[model samples]
Target: MLHPRITRVALGASVCVALAACGGGGGGSSTAVGGNSPPATSNAQITGKAIDGYLSGATVCFDNGQGACDLSQPTTTTDANGNYTLKVSGDATGKQIDVLVTPTTVDRSNPSGAPFTTTFTLSAIVSGATQNVTPLTTMVVAQMNAGKSQDQATQAVQNLVGSSVDPGADYIANGDSNTTGVAADMVGHLEALYGNGPVSWTLVQATMNAYAAVGNVEGVQQSDVNTQLSNMALSQPIAATAALADSLYAVDGDLIQESSTGAVVSPGLSPVRENWTLSGSTLSITQEVQSSGAWSAASPVGSYDGWFSGNFIQNTAGLGAMLMKTDGTWTNWFPNSQLHPAYALSSVGNNLVGTDPNTGDAITASYRTIDVSGQPLSTALQIDYRNPVRGSMSGTFPTGTTAYLASTQHANDQLMLTESGIGTAQSGSWSASYSPGTGVYWSSLSDPTQTLTSVQQVVGTQIQVDGPCLLLHIEAGGVAQIVESGASGCNYANEPISFPVAGSWSVYPRNPNVITISLPKSVGGATVPITDTIKNTINAGGSLVVALVNGVLLSGYMLPASSVSTVQQFPATVTDTIAAAMRAAATNIGETQNP
Candidate 1:
């Protein structure tokens, strides 16, 4: 003869009773009536027991009959005896109902077990208002007979959030509050794994928003939200697990610790230490992991466990659609998305991430992981000087002192030269030297060796250089005090200048005898007499007319003298007579012209 095993399973609100109900009741079973008659009352009680391998926390829900109904969301904690009572109102008449007892604290699908859901078809209620229910046999077990661990569950949550696919309506509807809270906690782990990227503010702000939304329906208080956000700044991963455990025990202790092998799950699901502090939007992590297991002096890692002080609004503006794969390949949904541009990678424990300096939104820190392997070496650098020219100018300046730079688009071996003020011809030579401690180059004016010295520098719009003697043009501002002139004194006169044609002309006064005329494409090779109106005196020099044919400078006598009188020779081609006179006079024409 075989024996029947009878064990007690807790059910109801402090109501534990022994049942002889039958799934396959063999020995000492209660007497049953073998009839198909329906019970009197439509409102009947259906109670059962669920057995599982591990049960740190569990919740039962009634689907189909009561829709998405779970006892956990609507009620408080189950007693220490693991017993719960749900006052469900339903018409129990030939309807199949699913009694789902999901493990609230563990992930079921990770170990590849059949999903835990139990169903029981109820006939008509035939008992009194209250009836004795018995064991409805249904058990949940993991695949490969594996036990679910807290860290595995946490990792699963992280992977889910980090995935591009949506959590699905079922996961969101069922897992919501607890799951999102878990996601917030998992961000810390990601921070540990991947330091804050340039888009950390968007990631963190989205996380905070999701957590807050989850809290709204779960009756989580604003105070709790405040505390959790504050703690996250100190590298504490969000404890959605602990929050679920709220119905169990108070988990207000440490859950994460720095290990040599990298960030590992502590004994429980709380932070390992809370020694970190946040002040004025700055997060300071004083905890050190001395073990080289996870990271060394060369390769350090960080956690997303802390708050990255940054502007969330500006960051969010740059985040359109985002795609993150389980394999950690992430890309923006839109090609135009731009986040906090000033973020850089940093580490916490064994994770690498980036930090954003918040300038628009509230003083807050945002962080994300840095994919270093996918990153390039030379990204971008600040342009020291923009548009350096040969004259006076200014622009968005750098730090330290006002800088004046010679244009980079200059002749080779030339240096940036400048004066205290204009007119006196004060100038100096400049070479490229990096700022002593910054990314600026300090050009030296006195050093002839051209050796550069690092110093904090400012960018100037114009830098001019004077070698030996330079031609000075007197403009509206000041008079030129010609210094160290090697040539004879320059005679200044308001002589009118004229253009023979609309083309470009270069005036090279060879002993003041002639000026060269460069004709435009239209005037080139044309036989028309070139006439010019003199607006100013011709600086005591004669002029020559030269033609450019087919883009080539052709030497010609386009305006030759008439071989008559010197003064009245072919004024029709004004400069032609000048050139012919200079060619004819053995005594240079520069001696005769004084206009």
Candidate 2:
């Protein structure tokens, strides 16, 4: 069984009024009460239409000055046309009061269910005042559905408000109190998610009022509203699951260790990117990680257990280790142990959320389904991840951070570079290509001035990038950082040369600039350091564009398949304009690091 948690927050109110005079005195008016004056008494007629039509025979409860809707206070029932006249007395006369509208037949569909209720805040009532209250009751029936979760109900109400009327203008024209309260609640929720900002009630109310004037001119039908709610409840899981099947997704994010008090115990390393493939009911994830002067690989296998609810997809059980060799050969490292693991995956918008079913450890990550048949080289992409780490607590990963995987790929090959810090430039770059029928290949180039390269080939999880004067140890599903940089003999230039380099690199999807390279510069000597970063822009066709970043740039392109050209480009100066900019900014190279 699937369980969903929903939270209910108070909603703002807006009232529409209509007035009729019959037995009331003609041309008889009551004195307007002042702010500080004692409360005045008045017999007010509150009238409004219901959602579908006039709310006749509906019970209306009004609030006194004490906050709660004091049923003992004056109340009334709407006439056949959904019109109600209330007789106000005591403190309720001069103060804004809350009104709860309840229909006689609560269950519009079931007929036997409990009554449906809707609340709205109305201002001080004067004699002969009429208000349209249809907007308030629009969501009453939806909220009354006992089968839906609170979140779903609230969302339904919000949708109803948006579809039926213009909340901004309606609330403002009716009264400022309703607008203020509603805006407060919405802004509060936003602050909790993306951190606090300059959110104020006054600003919210003004914005809402401005938009509400252009209300829902094309009124929504009750049947359409019900259909939308029903569709959302039943079709979300099926849609999400269909989108996930037989897809290749790229994962990019960070891994960190945080303390119980929500402080960073250790700053996370640079972000990592991995690829996952879901073939039918089985799923396998592969990652290439560089460590020291070598590269390695890892493939964790799992199975899908269909959709749970909302955005979540369940993974029933599966072993979590690679069973195939990097050369497409078979190998069983965990022959004696069950590699099956269970978890849940959910996609919230464009991002992916994964949770540990056993421990309930959840992470909000991001991924993009890869179209293998499409031209990968020309597509601009953006990947986001929310990595939730397990803290010192028993069942919590209090610390979380967002990471991005932005890059352009061609065929089955990719090149990525990123820079971090300031002063002395510390940067790293790597390229990889894979063919399922053949195997996998990779290379790396990490140095400030020297043209040192490393390349390697391996079968299974072990991988390497070996090049002239450079050799890096790496593994699939491992962190990629510049582990070593210097002259290591394979120098094509022959003159011994080396420069220590460090930092991080990554590729973005949406950005035309596919790669980011960051390097650290030494201040004075090597004690104080700063960072210099460069972003390599790409054309719409996914080819690299030579552009300057603080006077530094790196550019690469692909060669035709018929040509005997390798994916290699020696270090070269950019255009004179860019070269001049680099010289001009040379003195300020390590002043500050790129965030």
Top lDDT prediction, candidate number:
2
Q: Estimate every model's Cα lDDT from 0 to 1.
A: 0.21, 0.25
TM-score of each: 0.17, 0.24
Worst 10 residues of 1 by lDDT: 136-145
Question: What RMSD, rounded to one decimal, does every model reach?
Answer: 37.5, 26.0
Which regions of candidate 1 are displaced past 4 Å?
1-42, 45-275, 278-287, 290-361, 364-595
Q: lDDT score of model 1?
A: 0.21
What lDDT tens digits, residue by residue, belong to model 1 across residues 73-173?
A: 32222222333343445533222222222323222222333222111211111122222111111100000001223233223323433432222112222
Best by TM-score: 2
Candidate 2: deviation at residue 369, Å?
36
